[model samples]
Target: MRKMARHKDVSPEHLPYRRCVGVVLLNAENLVFVGSRTEGPEHTDSARPWQMPQGGIDDGEEPYPAALRELYEETNVRSVELLAEARDWFTYDLPPELVGHAWKGKYRGQTQKWFALRFTGTDSEIDIHHPAGGAHPPEFKAWRWERLERLPELIVPFKRAVYHRVVQEFAHLVG
Candidate 1:
């Protein structure tokens, strides 16, 4: 079974099953941040699709904090002013291959808690290598701001459906 973190203030029953979190960062131009994954040897020369920053929640971590952490780790962007957060969690099942070996039996996939944040800081604030903290060393090699409505078409296939839903739910912020 996948070990999921539960908040101290909330009971497990109240939390979404297999919870994760994602950050949707919007700039003043109303463009959303999108990133290209570093090309692997197997995918060399192939265009890597873009995605918003996201990741799993750690034990005892809340969704919003996880979202902020992922944003910094993935894009080197921070100081986000949160605009909104989903009232309910969105879920998608991971393909079997994507599941960890120990979690295959209990989990069908992941349930994600999402947040929308406006970038209040200048572009200079984005540092893919700030020493304060972040997730991985940065899996993304390149990034740019794109129209929110077009994100569903630009992201990887696995994330397309959720991106579509997120766009719809947060369309008000885009305009």
Candidate 2:
């Protein structure tokens, strides 16, 4: 017989997932928005830190607005038009090493609703150095437009599943 044991004090299954919203901003060239995460645990992987803009869902917020809010908050992009929403919510778990450490120990990982939007403005409008009227620090140091299919390769492994699903769901809309 085999047995699986879990920590009683903080079992992985008992931890709540963070509710988050993800944004996939697409430009006229059919490129998707991606950014390099500027924050995480000191020893976190730097190689695959690039990701789409995402953030926690505030209390009493709807997913669509949250997605747009996160987009503006992270990338200073507000000239976008709603394109599509993912068919369903997606989730991923952080490695045990990250639990109790990431997000101030508030979540095991994130359950996210992703939104796709078309950029109706120019590249010069993007300012990762300043976001949401400068009310919050930027989450990314650099940003770029990439093919939608490349997202899984750029994101951290823990969140790759969601990115892969996003790519699959949005692939038909890509050029």
Candidate 3:
């Protein structure tokens, strides 16, 4: 049997999964939104550090509202219409190297409720450089619309599984 990794004198398995939300923001072309992460340990993947906008659910916030909040906070996108929610929450574990170093060692991984939203505004409204500013810093250095099926290929390897599931869950909605 494999042994559980320990961090801060505690086993990683003992830590709780953080509750979070992910958004698949699609434009009129049916392409999905992806952002290149501001270089960091988690963003070192060779394929591309790109990922959809995502964030933790604040205490007392519902998943849907949290999804909407996270999208706008990261992308400065507000003209979106709800399309569909994933049939189930998806999750992924941090790779061993990131086990306790990511997210300030607060979570073993994240259990995310994913949302699919259609962009109702033009591409000019998108801005990764100046996302809703306040407490949140810019998470992305650049952004683009990508084919929906290619999302899993562009995300960090540790997060590919969840992105695969999201693609499968929302594939039918794409053109």
What TM-score do all the candidates reach, one by one? 0.76, 0.92, 0.91
Winning candidate number (TM-score): 2
Query: In model 3, which runs have C-alpha deviations exceeding 4 angstroms?
Result: 1-7, 133-135
Candidate 3 per-residue lDDT, tens place, 1-175, comes to 2334445544578878899999999988999999988965466564577899998999999999999899888888889999999989898887766666677778888999999999999888777788875446788888888999998888877888999899999999994
Q: Model 3 lDDT vs. the true structure?
A: 0.85
- Output the better candidate (1/3) by lDDT: 3
| Runs off by more than 4 Å, candidate 2 | 1-9
Model 1: per-residue lDDT, tens digit, 1-175?
A: 2343322223223333466898889999888888776642112223446877777798999888888877877767767898999877887754433334213334445689889999998887775544135545766767788999998887655567888989988899977
Candidate 2 clash pair list: none
Relative to the unseen true structure, what is the Cα RMSD of model 2?
A: 4.9
Error of 2 at 90 (Å): 0.5
